[model samples]
Target: MIKKECCYYQSSTVKDDPEDEESIIKGMTPNPLLKKNEWGWAIDPIGFRIALKEIYARYKMPIFVTENGIGVREELNENKTVEDDYRIDYLRAHIEQMKLAMEEGVDVIGYLTWGCTDILSSQGEMKKRYGFMFVNRDESDLRDLKRYKKKSFEWFKNVISTNGKQL
Candidate 1:
């Protein structure tokens, strides 16, 4: 990894706890850096650019965006389709920053979002979903784990097919 200068990079947004001494020392506070969402920090696409530039400058390496996305409160519509415009916008903004990084000579090889299908998160919950495909079952109720393609599914498909030119 060091010789090739290639590594996987993940980006996300975070806010410091008000009561934490480290946060107080660093003067970190909940700001408008990310969208306000109930699940967690909303998407902060510029964070991708900042992190990519800093890492490239420091390591001079190729980066594979391994896991980057937002967890959203998604629900199926009457037609059982998920119109996840939030997810699309989130991905588009991040990808735009990635393009900027490449323009600035950052060797970005690939990108992948977290939880491509609705699955158990690190916290083992299904409510906090980050996926292009939506699974129909939640935790503790595995009656029928039906999978449905979300609106972002075709969006991402086109992105991959066009090499992101269409996006």
Candidate 2:
């Protein structure tokens, strides 16, 4: 089975009071320990692990993670490169959770990211970028549309080359 799980920001510190029905209905409160994206979504890796475990427990089928990534506002530096350390940290934490899930026998078959290059967001916003390769363009104008690899690109390449062992 194919599962697409996107991790959202959650707070470990704040627990919903079970007695309070409103709290239960309201769901998790967002308290980002790491950082939030441009859209204010929490960058929580634990969500990924929880999703994997829940899906595996319920379905008992091998899962293919088809889409997972973080979107952030990126800007090109003077060197024509994007130093997206936030993206790297986000992916690393999620990947670590996936690895842990695998250790716990989640039966994950494969993993794929949301996008490889910057593009229009689902909300049709170009500023909310998600990709290892930054596309040179904005919401208003398409300036050259050149592709530049972000810092996360090389880090992810190494992670893949090492089969995630180095991560």
Candidate 3:
């Protein structure tokens, strides 16, 4: 049960509100404490646990977290490495939620991140990246396409090696 954005940016091309309701509902509101991303919205990592509890209560099945990450605008340093502490922070928060859900008896089988390497997004934006590894290519410019490991790579490796205990 992977969770990302609850609300997304509405395209200017679209004429009407997709939900046909105001962005802000009376009782239903987004969390204010979560960190905001480049897209001008916050992601509730705690919601992951809440959602997991609800889903586990309704459907008793082994859950898998697929496609979980943040799309941040970043760049490689002159040393050809990316110090993506933001990605690490995002992942750590969500993983902490998963741990809490597991403590509450949710059967989470596996967790998978969105992308291991930089890839073209559906909107054709390379700047909006969600990857532990950075590919040396842009939207219009395909450079060497060399894969460079980001700071999150080592952190993720440690997390996996510790069976998420370190996280």
Candidate 4:
């Protein structure tokens, strides 16, 4: 129904209203109040690893890394290519960390990223994209829809097929 445009764009460890301008601002971008390398966007990798470890230790259970995708306003090319290398880098980093965690004896399950196709932002900004398949739709206009799978999509599919060996 109403996915991103409805109320989303939140990637917080602790859930918050995505529609809230203040909350989105605080969560999406770096928190000004926070020190340069204190929290949030300061160093997402360390923070995410610590969080996963803590949570795994507490539950001591099998965990599926169910949602981990990068959001970016993709640019399409004449060949209908949507280059989202930032997203690829984002996922590669997380997958590497996840593999490390599994090596540490964490019963880590599969990791599912946030989006597979572009959608309008909860705050009404299609510009805020998070998907391998680019959907040409913005907040103000739905526009003629087009789904162009990106290199990351192919890269991800290969990674999955090779069972993390492709990375």
lDDT of 1 by residue, 84-116 (tens): 998898889889999998999999898888867
Name the candidate, 2 or 3, with the larger TM-score value. Answer: 2
Please write out the lDDT profile of model 3 over residues 1-167, one tens digit for every residue.
54433322211222234453424444333344456687754676776677777777777777777778888887789988999988898889889988999999999889888888887777988978889899888878888888999999999999999999997
Off by over 4 Å in 4: 1-43
lDDT of 2 by residue, 22-124 (tens): 2423454445465667666667788789888887898787888877788888899999999998888888999999999999999988877778898798889
For model 4, give the RMSD to the true fold: 7.5
Compute the lDDT of residue 88 as modeled in candidate 2: 87
Q: Which rank order by TM-score, best down to worst?
A: 1, 2, 3, 4
**Clash pairs for candidate 1:** none
Task: Say which candidate scores most in TM-score.
Answer: 1
Better of 2 and 4 by lDDT: 2
Local distance difference test values of all predictions, in order: 0.76, 0.80, 0.76, 0.65
Candidate 4: C-alpha lDDT: 0.65
**Total backbone collisions for each predicted model:** 0, 1, 0, 0
Q: TM-scores of all models?
A: 0.84, 0.82, 0.81, 0.72
For candidate 4, lDDT tens digit of each residue in 1-167? 32111112123433354555545454344444432321133425444565667667876666766667656656688978876676787778777877777777777766787777876656767777778888866777667887888888899899889999877
lDDT of 1 at 12: 38
- Provide the lDDT at 26 for model 2: 45
